[model samples]
Target: PLIVDASSDFFSRKIDFSNIALFYGGVQKNAGISGLSCIFIRKDMLERSKNKQIPSMLNYLTHAENQSLFNTPPTFAIYMFNLEMDWLLNQGGLDKVHEKNSQKAAMLYECIDLSNGFYKGHADKKDRSLMNVSFNIAKNKDLEPLFVKEAEEAGMIGLKGHRILGGIRASIYNALNLDQVKTLCEFMKEFQGKYA
Candidate 1:
């Protein structure tokens, strides 16, 4: 089983072929809400499960047999999934979504690099996530809250960093447009000018 944090748009990244079974995450950065999780499995693997007598709710075969209508699945969650899927399709499917995400992340990274140590990115440059642009302000112990406040004032919501890693984290999901990223980049420049 592959344990993935798909909630943060990890699916947009390149998939390694070694993965066999992909599990689900309940929150949405890509999936788009709470109480909903999506699982993807290889069809060949399902055939092997035929001999196992797993509980109906726990068995993939049972769920497939019932067409995922098994055991009173969350109705509202399914609706939201459909909505998100439609939006994704309208945006030209996953390829376009990944392209836009890559562009947005590159824009943010460019701004961060231009900050000349005033801005620092959290993820390793090689393994940096395209979805969550995690970073920190130089001397962030003083600049962190101000950066968040200024971002909020500039109409940039959710620019605050994760609690586990204090600093700023801009989650650039598919729903976030390039304009929003440009706005945030401009704000970052302004903040750096004032603080650096």
Candidate 2:
């Protein structure tokens, strides 16, 4: 069966699920509060798990049969997901959400592009992600740690990059407002002035 793990960009925009067998993602990043995941599987796919020896928790058919109540669930997380859905609907659905996310990502990329070689984005312009904007201190690579520290001090946390690909990664999720992104871009400018 075809399975998709769209953990990062799950609810940011509308998806064409016409032929998708299964779509799943964590609620932490773009969907809702943490501690839960959302899944959408075709009924035909669930039939494949029926009469199988798989554990109840591992069997999609089991959960489908029990209406997703086969065991204790993350009730609070589900409630929050509902609330997030309400918010999304109030904001005019995924099209509006995608527009806001695109604006936020564009603002960040513009900051990186205009940094005069101080900040170098990791992704090419064509492949940049709306969820995470990653970059490095082009002038002095060693200053990334200090940049993270100072960014935290300035009340902008979670800018550190993954260990394997060391740099700055700013996650602009659905909950992050445009003003917060402006704050990040402002911080980038101020930080560059202080260290560049």
Candidate 3:
């Protein structure tokens, strides 16, 4: 069985694909829009892919042989991915990007952690997400509606939590620069002061 790394989870925290048999992630997660995915497979793993009889379209070796030009590619999406990669590299590669991501997550998480019962973080401290900071209002949970409403009114959007895990999910993706995170954090502080 090939070990798979779904880089969606802790990718921003750290990325070390060397030890994995396979790794994959969608650009939608951080790089760009949807309809694009990046995958990596070890050379030995590819050579040993047991199912040689599988159709070429379903074979990694075939794609590798053709440099992923086995068929028409998602040209536009790939272009966008390249642009994003260039931007990230220009900003000092993964090290600097990860540093900024960590800082942004920290700013938002700190706001949640220091709210003194006004905001309650969803994940455990050790398990908190660096990409999506999920949390909720402590006392008047009902005020979550008002909170989301006011946040939207204040020019911030996409803070509502999923239904399965209702609350707020501040997605601090790589594309979001530090200034944006600071604004969100500032809004969090102002909202807490007024409503908490």
Q: Where in model 2 is the C-alpha error above 4 Å?
A: 51-53
Cα-based lDDT for every prediction: 0.79, 0.92, 0.82
Q: Candidate 1, residues 1-196: lDDT per residue as tens digits?
A: 5555566764454466468465555546676677777766667666666766776678777777787888888888888878987888888888888889999999999999888898988888898888888888865558888888887887778878898998899988778899989988988898888888
Candidates ranked, most accurate by lDDT first: 2, 3, 1
TM-score per model over all chains:
0.83, 0.92, 0.87
Error of 2 at 110 (Å): 1.0
The superposed Cα distance between candidate 2 and the true structure at residue 35, in angstroms, equals 1.8
lDDT tens digits, residue span 16-35, model 3 = 77678877778877776688
User: Over the full model, what C-alpha lDDT does candidate 1 score relative to the true structure?
Assistant: 0.79
Error at 48, model 2, angstroms? 2.8
Return the candidate ranking by TM-score, descending: 2, 3, 1
Which runs in model 1 stand beyond 4 Å of their true positions?
10-18, 43-66
**Model 3 local distance difference test score:** 0.82
Number of colliding residue pairs in each model? 0, 0, 0
How far is 100's C-alpha from truth in model 2 (Å)? Answer: 0.5
